[model samples]
Target: MKAAAIFGPGDVRVMDIEKPEPGPGELLVEVKACGLCSSELGMWVDPNFKTDDPIFFGHEVSGNVVAAGAGVSKFAVGDRVTIFTDRGGYAEFVTVPEDWAIKLADHVPYDWALGEPIGCAMNGTSRSGIEVGDTVVLIGIGFMGGLIQQGARLKGASRIIAVDTRPESFELAQKLGADHVIDAREGNAIQRILELTGGEGADVVIEATGKQGALDMATEAVRIRGRLVIFGYHQGGKRTIDVQAWNWKGLDVINAHERDPQAYLKGIRTGMKLLEAGQLDIAPLLSHYFELKDINHAFLLAKSKPDGFLKAVITF
Candidate 1:
């Protein structure tokens, strides 16, 4: 079997490894597509964050079940499935806990079945407290950012403001239902967001960039007493927040990352429902594809995020 591993910083290699068998209460999946996550960038390049063990880092994945271990009756062989696991997804095969594998409908595309990432964004949107007619601002319109914008709109936000440094994402943001797309390159994102909201800032501001600058901008762009959802995977470092500003505004800060199994399972189910209903479109958001053998290059492309590169999937 072949799999990708990060032996150390700046090193991603496709190498032969033993095929894993499903343990009791698990399933052995033949991976079809695995989505590259932004968090992998820091884990792949930063020495401080490097791990001593070889890391197979992809988490957003979809595949077909080849076999199910004892006690796994919820899914059967040949079922199309997506999984969220600790590791082992960037490979030709992976072992998923039966509970972690969400069976997909026959019509679900392998790439669109990348429900783990969608579930993540759904968790953040749920935390954002966006209401009908509420003004919502999303910072950093990357893949997750873009999807969350659509989620906000679906949740009935009247005004959706999308922010990002990449001009390439503006059009997609608008297409995703952002009424206003602010180019952060202009250096007055906060002021402009304030202006767009008639000086009150947004009712809900989601910090999705994972950058310190975007976090600071989100703090300033959120209205007093409004909910501030932190959705970014803030790489590997310390980011100081403006405690004074937050105190003055009396903001409701929510760190929105779901780790519990039940939470993840519930979110994944909801994400699948939204995708089936055409409420959340994963098509426009998937902009690049690569093969498993080119996993290293794929990681580079994901890190660079060249124009039109919102998300990259390693297709098996």
Candidate 2:
């Protein structure tokens, strides 16, 4: 078996390694596809972030089950599955608890089956308490942000506003069901959102940029008594927020991370159902694909953000 291991910043190498066997109640999956997330880039660039011994850098994974350990009953050998977790996926094989391995439907494509980020976005959006007929503002139009926009539309948001510095991202957001797109770099985003919402700030504001400025903007763009959901993984140190603004508006802040596995499972089921019903199309979101041997090239392409680069996948 071959796996990409991270030792330190700018130090990732693919090396032959012993295949992992399933422990009790675990299953071994022969990975077919894995998606590179932004958090993985942060971990790759930051020297302070520590990983598990012999770190394998991936979470969104889809594959087929080759073997199952004792006490596993829900699935059998040769079943197609997806594994969602914090790490240990950028390899030919990954061993996980049976509970974390979700069986995929026959109609689901192997590449698209690795749609774990959609589930995360769903969980975060649901927790933000988006209401029907409410004006919603989503900052950032990356992978997670795009999915959040789709989820907000599905939730019946009256107006969906998307903010991003990149013109391509804003365009993609519109295609993903955003009613309005704002180029934050071009002008005052907060004022534009307020103007569009009829002088009353957005009913729900979500910050998905993971940048300090975006966080501050979210705090300012939300309406009085509105909910603000922070779904981005902020790699930088402490961020400053205007205490006076939040205090005066009586706003509710919610910090969402991938913690609820059950919630994620439910979201995955919903996403699959939507895909099967042709109500949601994620195929357009996939930007690039690379073979397992070209892992370093894949990382470089993701960093470069070439045209049509939204989500990059490494296929087996």
Candidate 3:
């Protein structure tokens, strides 16, 4: 089996490795597609980042079950699924616990069935507590953010305001059901969100850029008692927040990242159901695709984020 092993920053090599077999209560999936997540970009670009082992990486995966280990009765050898595995997805095969794998409808393509990030978006939406007719502001309309925008609309948000620096993002956000868009480069995103919310801030503000500026804007663009959902994958270093302002505003701040495997599994199940029902479409967000041999190139493109790029997937 061929697999990608990162030796250091900017150094990814494809090497022949032994394919892993499923353990008890696990399913061995033949890799069909895996997404290149921004969260792992540090491993490819940050020179200071170090890893004890590099064999198991790339988590967003969708494939066909090739073998079912003992006690795995929920799925069979021929089942198609989007799996959650902390193993090497950038390979010919990977094994996941049966509980972490969700069925993929026949209609959903393998490349677009990026279960992990889709689950993340769904979990974030659930934590947002978006009530019907609530004004929702989403800062940073990237891949996950765009999905969240769609989820927000389905959650019955009265008005969806999208904030991003890219013009393409504004267009996509509108297409995804955002009622208004703000250019973050204009230096008045907070004010614009306030204006759109009728002098009061939005009912719920979500920061999805994973940047300090977007986080600051989200904090300021929420109403006194509104919920602020941090849905972004913040990396690199620590961030500073205005604690005094949060204390005074009586805001409900929620970090929307899920650590518990059960929570992630639940979100994946819900997201897959939504995808099967045609309630969510991720076709447009998959902007780039690469073969497993070109994993390094895929990482470079994801890190640089060339024009028209949203998300990159490595296909078997």
Whole-model lDDT, model 1:
0.87
Best by lDDT: 3
Better candidate number, 1 or 2, judged by TM-score: 1
lDDT of each: 0.87, 0.83, 0.90
On a 0 to 100 scale, what is the lDDT of residue 233 in model 1?
Answer: 85
- Tell me the lDDT of candidate 3: 0.90
Best by TM-score: 3
Each prediction's TM-score versus the true structure: 0.95, 0.93, 0.97
lDDT of 2 at 10: 64
Q: After superposition, how far is residue 259 of candidate 1 from its true place, in Å?
A: 2.1
TM-score of 2: 0.93
Q: Residues 1-316, candidate 3: write the lDDT tens digits.
A: 9888887888888888888889999999999999999988888887876665665688999999999999998999899999998887888999999988998999989997888999999999999999999999999998999899988988989999999998778878977878889998899888888778788899999999899988888889999999999998898799999988888889999999899988988888888999999999888777898999898999899888888888999998
Poorest stretch of ten by lDDT in candidate 3:
48-57
Which model is ahead, 2 or 3, in terms of TM-score?
3
Better of 1 and 2 by lDDT: 1
Residues 1-316, candidate 2, lDDT per residue (tens digit)?
A: 9988887666667889999999899999999999988777876677686655667778889899999999999989999987776547889998988888778888878788765787787778778789899899999988788778888888889999999998779778978878889999877998999899888899999999889989899988999999888988887688888889998999898987766777777777677666666666677778899887787777777777887788889889
